[model samples]
Target: MKTKITDFFKLVFPSTYSEVAVFLFFIVCYGILGSYIAIHYRIIFDNRIPWDAYFSFDNKSILMTGGSFERHPLSYYFFNWVREFSLFISGGKMDVNFRLTLAWLSNIIITLNIIQVFKYLKNIIYLPLWLSLLITLFFGVFSTNIILSFTPENFTYTLFLLSLYNYYAAIKLRKEEKIPATALSLAGITIGGLTITNFVKVFIPLIFEKDLFRSWKKFGNALFRVAITMICFIVLYLNRIDFKYQNIFSKTNQQYEKFSNVKSMPTWDMIFSFFFGGNILFPGFIMSDKHNMKGFNFKGLYMDLYSSVIPYFFIAILLILISWSYIKNFKNKWVQIIIISFLIDIVIHCVMRFGLHTSYIYGGHFVFVYPLLLGWLFFTYRTSSKMMSFLTLTVAILCTYLLVNNIFRMLEFFWFMENYYQ
Candidate 1:
């Protein structure tokens, strides 16, 4: 066992053990940082307050009582179950355990995402493991702000990634002879369940259709599996105690409309500001008009510093280059599908006028885009000259450095506000 583990490290970090050491160091640092932020930003729901209030009943009863049966019913239940487990372990009290549960889940999801991306790069572009980690660490962490906030969205988001991973695996299996029946069945369930969580996720299966649509027999098998999934969804939907078919669409539409007309920053405006909102060096958090004071109130020095470093034009040009790289690889069906899905997400958000706020944009929307950009870079220049590699490495280091500095500064400012400044 020890020999195998050592061999794995040697495989990942070839010549010296130095790179392996560095990777482990970053892993520890990020683990700590992610846990701290998630705990710090823990949100209380269902009118629960005082940080450590005890629940009124047994954990099982608490979990069964609070659920949004109208949408993502299973996920809603899952979120409550997680909270109940935390409360159970905390001896009927609500405390940091709730946030800790979420933070741990978020960290696990991020690790799984990194693993999936690494596998994709290795299989598709023959990328070395070390380079894969470097790129994944920089962009993965940069795009993970959404996981910090404890919300049902985290559960759905992690489910989405799981579904995507399974779908990717199915596609790969199909490429080699016939896909096993078990693989196809699991893929169908994951994708189908995703629809129940977020209907828009139904489109994700299409991302792999380029490889699945070669022959009628293959396509027919895929359809049969999906049919099974849809039937399962129907049964679940019908079983929900609060199920009201007529009111479902109307309720969803109303929520969408409410979000669109939020008296804060318009969806369109928030998106545009995101580019100019320090997205290159650090994550940007934009407050809306709804949260603004009636009179002038300071948004604090950290916010001012965050707002001051707007490298909009530079970042825009970099994005253009990234897009060009993907276009250059359009012949690769996977590349084409990924780029299209990402663009579809952008267009849908722009038109729907929802998910344009800082949190949503930072948290969830950029997920599709990150993989496209990261994959394109490694695929396009995997065997490039050392100078190119050097430049890429430099950019990764700079982004990591700036991101760590940004996190520390924000933490310091928040601490000061809570302790000394206030």
Candidate 2:
């Protein structure tokens, strides 16, 4: 009986009991700490932000609002139910309670996503417990978008990770046997989730087709799964189709054009911004305060802008070089897929021309590159000296620490606002 149970456990979790337990502890700690910070410190930085205000809207108001179901039809219903559930749990219907409830949900999902990342790292590479925890903490701190926010990105990321895991598992299984139904179903679900949440992520499936030409039957199965998921997405999409929100894309395009005329910076600034510009590495420091356009520069509050930019620029260069070096291991399809996916994410954001100020909004989308690069490096150089590994991990932690201080500053800014509002 013990043998059977152990087998079951092994099938379920790729990591050892201790590794899983340690990551689980980290997830819980991150959730609790992150929640306290967000609830006590983080303010509603902007009211104009639609995704941030998602939970604040009641069902009646939500339906009346044109953009409520625009990008995320499925999430619209789900978050409304969450808000209703939270209201019931609190026994009082204050907006603060709703935000708190949704923030907790977001934080938990974020932490779970972090755990999934650590698990993926464990599956791909062998690292010591201390190093693993440090890397996980690095991800928790620097991946600012996942910390706590009621956005569809949270759900999308969760689905993305799950799909990637299942997809990778399927690839391995195909070496021994045919793709299993469970793997196909999981991939289909991911497709559906990505479709409903953000079509931009539709590129994910393309990353998993390394064995396509070798096996037509396997490729056919993948196509079948995608086709079915896409059909479901089309049905769900058509159900929520209203002419009312059709103008949003056109309206945003006009805003984009207007913003584009602000004059492009030097080639160096553009290059630096491409890598470090989007508040990607340090969202807290780089992001402008909600009312900054009204005359408050956050950099002035922190330090000279150059000082802030210097560290992030170097970090960006480090990540890019690390990924590039690892990509030389052309034998590893997973490395290539992740690198390509990261590049695709960067290019899409660039083409959209998210400016220095607004680029932070989509920074979360590309932060997945960090874990991918780390995983690739750890595996490709598993035989490296301890000193080399220590240095690499140190850089990752330092980058995360820089982001942490910025988060504190962000909290401080909110704390200051609290006094004014009170």
In terms of TM-score, the best-performing candidate is 2
> How accurate locally, in lDDT, is each candidate?
0.47, 0.49
lDDT of 1 by residue, 253-369 (tens): 775675556455544345544422333344443322211233432222212213443334434545665676686787765665555655654565555555344323233433534
lDDT by residue (1-422, candidate 2, tens digit) is 79957844554443567656754775576556545544563232222233222112222233224233433444544445655776676575535555456556665555555655665566555566565566666666653443333332433344334434533543453344443445444444443333233343443544356576578887887677656556665566556555345654665566557534434344344435433443344333332233334453222122112346555655666666565646656666556555555665455445544343233444444555565566566656567789456657665656566566656655754454454322
Badly placed stretches (over 4 Å) of model 2 are 1-16, 37-70, 143-210, 242-280, 283-309, 354-356, 386-404, 407-411, 414-417, 420-422
Cα displacement (Å) at residue 162, model 1: 4.8
Candidate 2: clashing residue pairs, number: 0
Q: Each model's TM-score?
A: 0.71, 0.72
TM-score of the candidate numbered 1? 0.71
| lDDT of model 2, residue 306 | 31
Scored by lDDT, the top model is: 2
lDDT of 1 at 42: 35
Q: Give the TM-score of candidate 2.
A: 0.72
